[model samples]
Target: MTKTLQKTTALSTKNGKKSPTDKNLSARAAAAQIILQVLDHGKSLSALLPEIQPRMKPQDLPLLQEICFGVCRVLPRLEWIIRLLVDKPLKGKTRIVHCLLLVGLYQILYTRIPPHAAINEAVNAARQLKSDNFRGLLNGVLRRFLRERESVLATVDKHWQTNHPEWLVNKLKKTYPNWRDIIDANNQKPPMWLRVNRNHSSAENYRQRLAENGITAFPAENPHALRLESPVSVSQLPHFAEGWATVQDVHAQWSAILLEPQNGELILDACAAPGGKTTHILEQAPQAKVVALDVEENRLKRITENLARLNQQAVVICGDATRPETWLPQAAQQITGNKSAVKFDRILLDAPCSATGVIRRHPDIKWLRREQDIAPLVEIQHQILTALWQTLKPNGILLYATCSVLPDENGRQIARFLAEHSDAQLEPLPFPAPQAIGHQFLPAENGGDGFYYAKLRKIA
Candidate 1:
């Protein structure tokens, strides 16, 4: 269930006068606002961070991201601690102060920020929020937590072992026997994985280039993937402007490989925004005619930008995958000079999902996503699969992929599709899976984000 935070007025002085403008807002204050937007308003950190980061000082940018991401990562534990420290819940206009307190608690418990500095900044942030009344409360609560740190933390270990919401934890327990490992991985920071654009450079060549630039990276199981020892700015990567490589998860790189784009094949990358997998297909088979389709007009630019950087070409279109007839004929005519027939040799459906698998990469997902969201997402996936299946040529392949571990969105989804269509046959994936329908990759200690892949072939 979605919980909406009560809307409140802007910052003001204790005397009810308008306070200083946003320019004077500290990083701690800014982080508090971002956290409120996520936990209460249900906004995504990915979208909110970009809007907030540019306004912050370059040095403070990392700190801002750390506090916001860290708070979301261990939110349950922080809330648990809050209950023990504060006498009552902070509501309405005072809620931002509550978030500020969460920031202070997270810094004291998780980051290297000194307790004194963290508490001072947070109390000061409360003042910025015009909550002068809560300043002493914030100071006292943080100090109390620091004084009772060991005891408070010891109690938390017994009461709240996993930091995830109870509903999600229950779902995981039912889904995987090794549910604990999945939860552990979700709590840790995710590693950066890169996919070498084979058209521009081989993985070995890219690794050497990175080494030459003093960046250490190692090759993964995927031929073109390199896991960085430590993440660096894309600007620091050699020839990044020329798209020598891309920052993609090792699991995502498997989409193009599973599709097996052959020369002269017509491929459809449905829901292909920011075109990671679409460009991968082009890199593998440059001769293949690729149509990158997405519903979002704004995100289509990212696909074109990526294509131009890699010096690759694809027919980018903005259209609904679930209603292909509205746009498919024209796209077909452009590629095949035939308006009546619109069949693709290969299709990659990176369907919409709850994104439970990649929670570590985007911790905000844990809070923003609700258990009820899965059924609707499952229905949409079914719609796209049923619609796009018609666009696949007889004997052609369609790879159903999602960055989700839930069976309803993955293996069971495929099982239902196979049952409905006699012409559809499940083809074995390259990776191993405990399930008979599809391969599931759980977020691991130092590997790829969670992803699922089930390849299907159309019978003539």
Candidate 2:
């Protein structure tokens, strides 16, 4: 459930200009709502975006989103600055006032938006916030910010470098030891890339289609995707309606290629929702028997929509991956003609992870994920791996994957699992990258989102 911030301002009662109704809210109001919801209530940004977006105007959406994301991404720094300027921090609903200040500070510190303009609109936003009485407070804070920007930054960096949570930053320093570049890269802008379905189009053909349709193109540094000249929604791209491309980061698309599911084989894509890997599997081998399952049906509906757009098919079911009894192989075999029931040729365990890898697309990750969550996430990955390994046939391949660069969840987890499962043998990846330390894809500044994939064969 999404958490809502307590209303701090008198503005709601005073202004008909802003109301937090189901529809008809300005983008700034929506962004403010998302930011406060996440900060005060600990709701995730991904959860908030889908809820807040439907209520916003397209024109205001981008800036509003930037504010929500940017503040969260650099929140530590924003907060440090606030602490420097204000002796007593605002608390609770009144804390919304400080948070709105953060929305303003994030603009001044990081964004290309000019200082005066950011301050101007932010001060104006104060009016809508019902803190017109505090307009003087806003003006004083912003002017002090403009004059003392450099000195204030000196304080924030020593306190909040890398835009990470304090405990998380400490954990990174502990895990990575001498190097912190991975965390830094994870926080930066993520590269955009498209995977071409070999059945539908080749990279070269898609490049030509992109050029022909007036969409610019360049070959991605990654082998799996053709990078667009600039990132845009897939629907706006050329031949997207024809299913020629998908807006997946380079690391995500590689999971299917590495798994190498064959035609007519029964493959289980466990934890598959918003089904990228499931669809890509079908793209490669259209006749393959694919069963997709996620714990939540609502999440699976996104998978259904993406499948429809790609013109792909998979037997999508909603069930817990942690429980094999919940997903009956006998029933699935009847649906896909793999009635052997007890045996399956392949499984893709795209385990639920802490998601340290995809930070660029979801900056709020910096704020939401606690260091304590890592231990439990590691346990979850281990459990899912064990359950999927149980389903794999002898000599069948299993691709254990995560969109996490964390060593605990990727390499160490796999290493521990290998110790317990004697029959499982590691299958060397076809391509080796440096950060794939025993298959943990480290965050790369020059490359794709962080991902880890290890191929193992159950040799029992």
Candidate 3:
């Protein structure tokens, strides 16, 4: 079936009188499209947004975000509600019709939008998706849900404490016994945070800079970050045009600060992509020699762009963090007196994991990630950390970081690493470090995302 681009307030090329698509499509349309892509196309919403965002108007971006996010956040609930109404499941291409109904239910249940708009837009989206014939089926399912929202959702809540995948939720229960709060936290939206360019100016200085440029900010609960009072585009931010501040999670920003990378120190940012921590390292220690490495060449683009924006130079490489031999440069070997190529005064291994801690920011995780993914992630983190451990100079700091809250990933992983490597010692964190395992920042009160960090010293 041909997908129809039917939308509220306008129709597409088939019925076009003038412009094929609406010049100013409502937030619902864009959100619906992203939902379809994630549901029907099986794409990563976070990765897809950077590519899809350009066509969106700034005002509508948040709304577009809400649509994709709202559905994903409560996707399991939506699915649960969907199951209550539909007798037999729709499968394959026909399943998209089911997804479209989920969108309708999401709007009616979650958003402030009126039922008329939600119904019309969702129906039109179905029509646009070439599921017009299923429009009746979509309409019936959604309308039934709208009429029964309270009872259905109360049932969902009373019985279903979490909408997470069963295996994933079970793992969380096991790994994080006191993790209902953490699990609940990831189901909400993560705030947009900025790590102030401390080298150029203080966070207060940036706060004032932001106000001058018409951006409003609240004192970030995190020391180095400033939470936007309202989310805004980069163009509207003061000196953003001139590279004043960069978007980074408050929790992730802590790694660079904890490392305290000093001038003349050689540093390594391993598995650094979409280079938040890498840029923070450079932001804090401009004169420090840096090497940023990632396995995927495509992801290195973010490191390249971010480094360029910060006016910092790091030897950026597309190589696996697990295999430093492929990435180590000639000069780095001599700097550390190590024949194994580049050894560093300090290293930041921000290993990739299941990212369960960041679910609020990427709700797709609720569906895309499974309980089975965790052990392999631990295995990979183990390999990367073990491989990179030898590259640190004596007394070099290796900060193991993950946007994951599991004990196995953050605490146990560090514990296992310590047990295996007699040469490696879990160092006392700097003056500002949190007390939790290595440093486990929970979802609430931190006013930040869920994160884990463990600092280890290579015994210089």
Candidate 4:
């Protein structure tokens, strides 16, 4: 009902004491709250994970994430099964209960947990929410699901089983001829890719190190990228804290590769938060003068932290990309140590768009993003592109990139930019740049995430 009640219901146990089921109940409670926040309260799962995970025991955190991620991955099938079972939809204050049910069903259908224990824990989880009255109700529904599990699951053909939202499915169908392939790729577990810092060690050497540690990995076409056979935590990575390598998607690692940063050129990474590309650019060309700019201060803080960890330096600025003049002067002064005018020799505008490409990594995007959101995102992208283009020197290059497969945000957006700006010319990329006005890489294509890259050179 209310935020206070929801928090209390999620955390408090009977008699205000911890029981042997403490870990189980807490994990379920955290997962249920996260699902409710994302599905009902319109929050980002990525944003919520950091907030909720710390409150959970370290041993239970993985289970919590598994439950949350599993529910999101098969949400469409779960919703259909839920509708068939429940007499009516969960409403108002009872919405969190619905999320809890989804978590329970997720465990039963997907995880290796025993069905009885899953159902029992789910029933007990309701007690933690002070919905003890619904304990029997939860148990009955879950047991009923077990009885009809075979028939219910049989009706879930691929058409009805897709985890993507309708708007996204329709959009993808219109954009790509092989839409089903794209959907299939998005429903899978994303491979973990490592970007080996050339400054510290070669990718081959790192691959050998991984072998020594009994970890299996393969080199990517890009010499810097290494795709692990299985995903592991950063702590498990060798020289991770020492900055030898960083976890990045193979497709994402291409941004810096395509940008072609030279050793002495001034580079701009607009909308650079979390600094993945910002740090990559420096890693590629350690002597390059680079500026990392983002609008949010907190996100910008992450950029600096990433820089520090990688032992890289950049003039990090928190300012809107649409209003570059406000921060560009300060950024230039920091790079050159002179309060004088400066223009970028190369730029990487990793424009903000509906992140449709990495849906597998973040299934919640399919639920959170709406079709109408695209037009406004295009507007923001256009504004950022126009503003940032002004800062590029004549004959300098700018690489436009997005983790989105949407045509309107990728190819069409670049087409429109080319039509409007006579000074901008499309430059062929080193990799197989797709002939559709830019390079478009589908999800898992060449073992990379679905990404779009358009290299443009400012005509002198």
Q: 220-318, model 3: which lDDT tens digit per residue?
A: 656678988777877777776456788877877888987779889989888788787888888778888888877767678888898888888887877
Candidate 4 residues 1-460, lDDT tens each?
0010112133335687853234544788778877887787666667777656555788988998888877888898888888878998988888867887898899998899999999888888887877788788788888999999888777765354567888888888887899988998888878899999999899999999999988889998888999999888899899999899999998889999899999999999988888989999998899999999887776888898899999889999988989988998898788778768799999999888888888888887777778888898899899999989998999999999988899898889999999999999999876653466888889963388888899999999
Per-residue lDDT tens digits for candidate 2, residues 281-332, read 9988899888887877678888888889888888888878788766756446
lDDT tens digits, residue span 283-392, model 1: 89999999999887867999999999888999999998899998898798888788887789999999988888889988888888888888988998999999999999
Evaluated against the true structure, the overall lDDT of model 3 is 0.74
TM-score of 4: 0.93
Where's the lowest-lDDT run of ten residues in candidate 3?
A: 1-10
Global CA lDDT computed for model 1 = 0.87
Task: Score candidate 2 by lDDT.
Answer: 0.74
In order, candidate lDDTs are 0.87, 0.74, 0.74, 0.84
After superposition, candidate 4 runs with Cα above 4 Å error = 1-25, 158-160
TM-score of 3: 0.86
CA shift of 353, model 4, Å: 0.7
Q: Please give the lDDT score at residue 385 for candidate 3.
A: 92
